[model samples]
Target chain A: MKSVMIVGVGGQGTLLASRVLGRVMLDAGYDVKVSEVHGMSQRGGSVVTYVRWGDKVESPVINEGEADVLLAFEQLEAARFLPYLKKDGVVVTNTQQIDPMPVITGAAVYPEKLIEKLEEKGVRLTALDALSLAKEAGSQKAVNVVLIGAMASSLDIPEALWIEAIEKTVPPKFLEMNKRAFELGFHA
Target chain B: MKELLQGNEAVARGLYEAGVTVVSSYPGTPSTEITEAAAMYDEIYCEWAPNEKVAAEVAAGAAIGGARSFCGMKHVGLNVAADPVFTMSYIGVNGGMVIGVADDPGMHSSQNEQDSRNYAIAAKLLMLEPSDSAECRDMTKLAFELSEQFDTPVMLRLSTRIAHSRSIVDTVDRVDVPLRPYVKNAAKNVMLPAFARPKHEMVEARTVKEREWAEICALNFVEDNGSATGVIVAGSVYKYAKEALGDTVNYLKLGVVNPLPVEKIRNFANGLDKVYVIEELDDILETHCRKIGVEVIGKDLFPRCGEFSQKLIAEKMGVARDESVSIEESIPVRPPVMCCGCPHRGLFYALKREGVYVSGDIGCYTLGASAPLGAMDACICMGASISALHGYNKARGAEAEKKAVAVIGDSTFMHSGVTSLIDIAYNRSNSTVIILDNSITGMTGHQQNPTTGLTIKGDPTSAVDLEALCRAIGIQDVQVVDPYDLKATRAALKAALTAECPSVIISRRPCALLKTVKHKPALTVDTDKCIGCKACMGIGCPAISMKDGKAVIDATQCVGCGVCTDLCPKKAIG
Candidate 1:
C-alpha cells in the first residue's frame, strides 16, 4: 500500500494502528514512514496517524489524495479523513461515533450520514461497531484490535502479521481477549 | 511491531537506542521522558540538574570531554538554557551534543507557547524536527551524528504532537559508544575573553561550511513534481501541507530545519513562481529566504501561533473545508486542577486564606495559581521562587517578609531550589522556603525524581532525604510537616516565616494518585448538623457540593481525606 490513515479520538488505538502498520510493512521488506498527533490531543480530541509504505520512503509523510486505505476507529473521523484516501480508495471503519468536545459542548453536530457520504463518493466503505464486538469479546478496550483485525482482513494484508503486531504491541495480560476480538472483527 | 507507549516513554527509548552516554536535564512537559529513559540504560549516566541552564552547561561540559551528551527541556526551560545554547554554538563541541527541546504549541501543560526554533536561529545551531515517534527516534540518533560531524551541538525539536504521541518504532540493538579520552586544551575548551574572541570569528565561517554541508545532508530531500507551486516545510507542518496540496505542489521537505542549505533551497526555488514555506511557529525559514533575496509566502497564509492540521492548511490554501470540520461539539472549559485528594490543596487553601505573598516554582503544586485556589504570587521558572522571594522580601520589608514564603515542589527543590536556599542562608536573610514535597515530578505525569527512590521503569532506587539536605545546606532549623495536617502546616509556615534566620519547611505528602496511596472511605455529611458556614467550600474539593442550602458531600466523589471535615464549621461531615 502507498499510504494508510488511522483515525480516532485521543485515548483510542490510532497510534497503535499506525505503528502496527509500519512494523508489518517494514517486516515485509517495504520502507515505511509514519506521522501522528501528540500533545493536547491526548486529552480527547480528533487524532489522525499517517503511515506510508513502499520502496524508497524519503520524507516519512504521505501526501494528500495518496492514501490507499483509511482505517478509522470512529465513523465520523473516517468520513473526516475520507479525502486523504485515493479516489475510490477502500475504507475500513468502526461504526462508532465519539462526540468530540464541540459535539459534546453543542457547538457542532455529529454527522449522521458518514458511511452514506463516503459510499456516495465512490469510496469502498466497510463499517462495523467494533466497540460492541469488543464488549462481546469481554473487553471494551479491544475495540482498537477489532478495528485493526477488520482492516487486516479486508486490506489483503496477512492476518498473521497483524496478529503478531498486536501481540508484540499489547501488554501480556490482555492478549487472549484482544485476539478473540480481532477474530470476531475479521470475520464480520 | 506496533507498541503501546506514552510519548515520553518512546523518547526515552529513542535516547537509549541512540547510544547517548551522558544525559543531564531539568524536567518539563513533553521533554522529561528523554532523561528518564536515559537513566534506564546502565551504560548511560543521567541526572536531573537544578535548572535548565545548569543542565545545558553540564551536557556541554560532557560534550567537550568527548562524550555523547544530551539535555532535554520544555520550551520555557529553553529560555533558561538559552545562555549556554547561544554560547556553545560559538565554542562548538568535541562529541555530539543533542538538546531535546519539546515545545507545547497550544499551551498544553505550559504557561506559554514559545517556539524553540527561534532559539536555534538565534544561536546559529542546526535544528532537526521529527514528525512522529519513529522519527523522534531517528532524528535523535541522526542529531548526534550531525552534531559530531559539524563539531556543533544540535537541537532536536519536538512539539507537543511528536513528544506526547505514540507510534511503533523499529528497534535496534544498543551500541555502546565509549567516552573518548579528553585532551586538555584550555584555549579550545575555556571561553576566556582572549580565547572566546577568536572562537566568535570561527562561528561565522562555521556557518558557511554548515550551509554547504547541509546541501548534501540525507535528511533534506526534494520531491520533484512537474508543477510550479513548490512548497518547503519542516517538521509536523509537512504532514498537513502534503495532505492539502498533494501532487499539485512539488515539495522540498527539510528535516534539518536550520542552517538553511542556501544552494539546495535556491535550487528548489529556481523555477517555482509561488513558493511557500510552511512551518508551525515563527517564520525563521522565510526570513532566511527573504534575506537571500528569495520572495516566499509563509506566515501570510498560515498562522504564527497554534498547530496546523490538514483542514487548517486546506482552508488557508483556499480549498473547501472537508466534512471532518464538524466532527464534534465544542467542549466546556474544564481547566485542570489538583487531584481530589491532593495534599497540596490544604496548603494552597491556607495560603489563599492568609493572603501571604508566594513566589512559586515549577511542579504540580503550581496548580495553586489556578482559580478557586489563587495562592501563588509568581511562577517564573525552576529555582526562581527562592531567589525571587529574597528580592521581594528585600523590597517589601520585615512585616511582608514575615508573611511571605517561597513555594516550590519537592522535585523542583532538588533540581534547583537548593542553591537559592544556600544563597539565602549565606546572605543572612529571613525568608521562608516551603518545599511542597509531593514525592514525584507531578507536573510531568508523576515521573520519579531524586527525592523518589524509583526509576522511570518503576524500579526501586535510593530516595533523597529533604530534611537532611536542608540541614546539610547549613540551615540550623529544618522542620517536616504533613501537608494534610492543615493546623501543623499553618503553624510551620508561621514559624518559618517569623524565624530570625533563613528556615526550610518541608510539607511532605505523596501524590493522591500513587498506587500505594489509599484514600479514606468517602465521607458523608450529616445534614442535621449542617450550618452552611461554607467553610467546607474553601477546600475546593469537587467532591464537596452544595445541596438544600447546606454543604453536602458526594460520597462517590470524596476520597474521605476529611480535608473538608476540618473545613465544616459545624463538624457535620464524617
Candidate 2:
C-alpha cells in the first residue's frame, strides 16, 4: 500500500492534483480512496488531502508517519505537514509562499529557512520554484501539475501514464501548457 | 466500468438507478452535492427548496402523489425538518421516500456535533449507514425498496468522512420500477388526534417486526477470522477498524445501524472471547449492547467526541507501530476567512464602525464574528437574525432600537427571514434589518436561490424582489444601497435605525468570486504618505497587510474592492 499527502492553501489546485493521481492509480487497477477537506476549510485555509492506493484500500485517511510521499504546494505548508511523513518519505515541495492570516495581519512572522529545517530532520527533500517553472510552461496555475510531475519521479509508474492521467483530468484548452509543466518538473 | 465517486455523488446515482422521479434539497455542506448531482440526470426532476422543512415536505408530498422521492440535508438541517420527519414516520409513505441526513461528527463545518442515530430511534424509523461510495450507492437503492416494503420513510445517515471521501464504485443500469398507485386513506395519512392514535400503535408494531427482520438480514453479518477478540462497528468507523486490525479479529459490521440487530449481535458476541463496540461521536451502539444484557468495551477506551483515525484505533487495541516524529516549532493557525473581494466585507466593516449590535445569520457573512470585524453579537441559526433582533429591541426598548440591527443574506432572507419580518411588522417593533444581497448563495459553493433568478440547472426564472417583498410584508420603509459605496450604506443604516417602525436596508453587491463580475484595478499604497495607523487592517482583508510598518496590498491577491482605501486616514491608498 502507498499513501500520499497533498498539502497547500485553499484554491491552489491541490484537490485537482489528487484527483489526477486517483485517476492514474485507478487506471493501473489499484484500489484508490481519496479524502478531502470541504466547506469552510476551502476559504483561503490550509487544505490537506489523503490519497491511498493498493490491492485493497480501506481507510481514506493516512495515519501519522505513514505517508510514503508528501507533495506540498507552499513552503510553510510543507513544513506544517512534515509530521505526516515517514522517516524515509520523499518530499516534493514547491518553493512558493502564501502568508497565513496571522502573518499577514502582523500577529506573527512567516517562518524562515523552511527547507533547511526539513533537511535537518533527515528526510529526502526535493524543493524547486514550481511557480516559475509553471510560468515557463505558459500558465502559473500549472504549479500543481509541476509538483505532481516531481512526485512522479520517485514512483515506479511510467511518465506516459502520468501524462495520460493529466490529459484526462485537465480541460483541453490548457492541455499543452500543463503537459509542458509536468515534463519540466519531471526532469528538474 | 468503475469510477471514482464521492459518497454524495453515489447517493444521487443510486436515486437515479432506483427510478426515483422527484428530489428536493436545501444546500448544506456534505449534502449539497447530492441534489446537485441528481439534477444532472434528465430522468429526475430536482430543485433547491427554500429550507430543509420545505424540502422534506416537498419530497413527502411527491411520495404521497405516487412517486419515488428523496431529500438531502446536513445534520442541523434535520432539526429544521424534524417536525415533518417525526410525523411522517406515523403517516408512512404512499410510494417510497428516503431522507438523506449527513452528520458532521467532528463539527468540521457545523456548529454542533450531533448523532443522527438518536433521531432515527426517536422517530422509530429504520436507518442505514454506509461506509464507502459503493455502499452509499447500493444502500440508497435498498433504502427506497425498504421504504416501500415496510410502508415507512427510511433515513440514510452519513458522516463527514463518509460523505466527503471518494472511492471506486461500479456503475449500474437504471431499473424502471412502475410507481405504486396512490389511494386516499384518511386513517393512515391524516394526523388528527383520533386517527394519529391508531397510526402510532401501528408504527410500534412495525418497529417490532423490523427488529425481527433485522436479526436475519444479510446486511448485518459476521466475519470470523479465527481471532478471539471481536469488534462490532458500523459506518465509517468500520473502515477505520478494518484498516487497523486487518483480518486478525472477528468482525460484525452493521449496515442497518438503527433498529440494530440485537439477536445477531448476541450470537456474534457469544462466539468471541471479548466484545468491543466501535463508533464515533456517541455511544449509541454501546448503550444498546448493555441494555440487551451484552458486555462490551467502549467509550472507556475510546473518545466520545471528534473523529476516529486508524492510528487511534490501533493504539487503543494495543497494536504497535513505529514511533511518530513531531515538529519542534509551532506553526501559525490558518482558519478559514472571507474571500479577498467578498461582498460582506464592506457591510461588516461599516457595521463595526457604527458600534451597532448586529445579529447575524448563516452564510459566508457569519465571518463577521471573527477578529477584526467583530460586528455580529449573536448568531443562533438561519433566519434567527430578524426574530432575535426583534426580541432584543422589545426587551431593551427604544435605546436598543438605535444600536441594534439584524444582518442576513439574500438567500437566507428568502429561506426563513421573510416570516420573521412579518412577525416584526404585525407585533409592532422598531427593529432594523440589513439584507446583504450578494446575488447568490455565497456559502455551499454558490448554489442558486430564489433571489438569484435561476434554477439549479441555471435556466432563467422569476427572481424574488426584496423591496416588493418587504413592502408586502408590511414594512413601509425599504431602501437599497450599494455596499461597495460605504457612504450610501452608512446613510441607509442611520436612517433605518432611527426610524419608528420596522425598516429593512438591502445592501446590494454581487459576490466578487463570481466569474461574471468584473474587478476594478488593484489598489496601490503610496509609502510616501503612509501613516502606518493600521486602520486598513481592521477589515481583515487577506489582500492587504502591514509590511515594514506601512500598509501594503498584494496586487496579485487584491480584487480592487477599495473598501480598505476608505479606512486610510491620509488618503494614501489608490
Q: Best-fitting candidate, measured by DockQ? A: 2
Q: Candidate 2 - CAPRI tier? A: medium
- Find the 10 residues in a row with the least total lDDT in model 1 chain A: A99-108
TM-score of each: 0.77, 0.98
Per-residue CA lDDT of candidate 2, range B384-446, in tens? Answer: 999999999889999989999999999899889999999999998889999999998877888
Per-prediction count of colliding residue pairs? 12, 0
Q: Report the lDDT tens digits of candidate 1 across residue range B1-574.
A: 4443445566667667767788888878768777776787887888777678989999999999889899999999899899999889877888889998998876767777888888887898989887766777778888887888878999988887667654457667677777778888877778899998998888778888888878998888898878888888887777667767778888988888788888788899998888988888788889888988888998888798876766677778787742322223222333345667888998998788778998998777777776667798899878899999999998988887888989998877877788899988888778888888888777666677778887555678788888887888788778889878888888887787778888888888888878789888888878889976767776666556565577766543467777777777788989
Per prediction, the TM-score for chain B is 0.90, 0.98
lDDT of candidate 2 at residue B336, scale 0 to 100: 78
Stretches of candidate 1 exceeding 4 Å from the true structure = A1-188, B1-18, B40-43, B175-178, B323-331, B453-464, B471-477, B497-501, B525-535, B546-558, B570-572
TM-score, model 2 to reference: 0.98
Interface RMSD of each: 7.4, 1.3
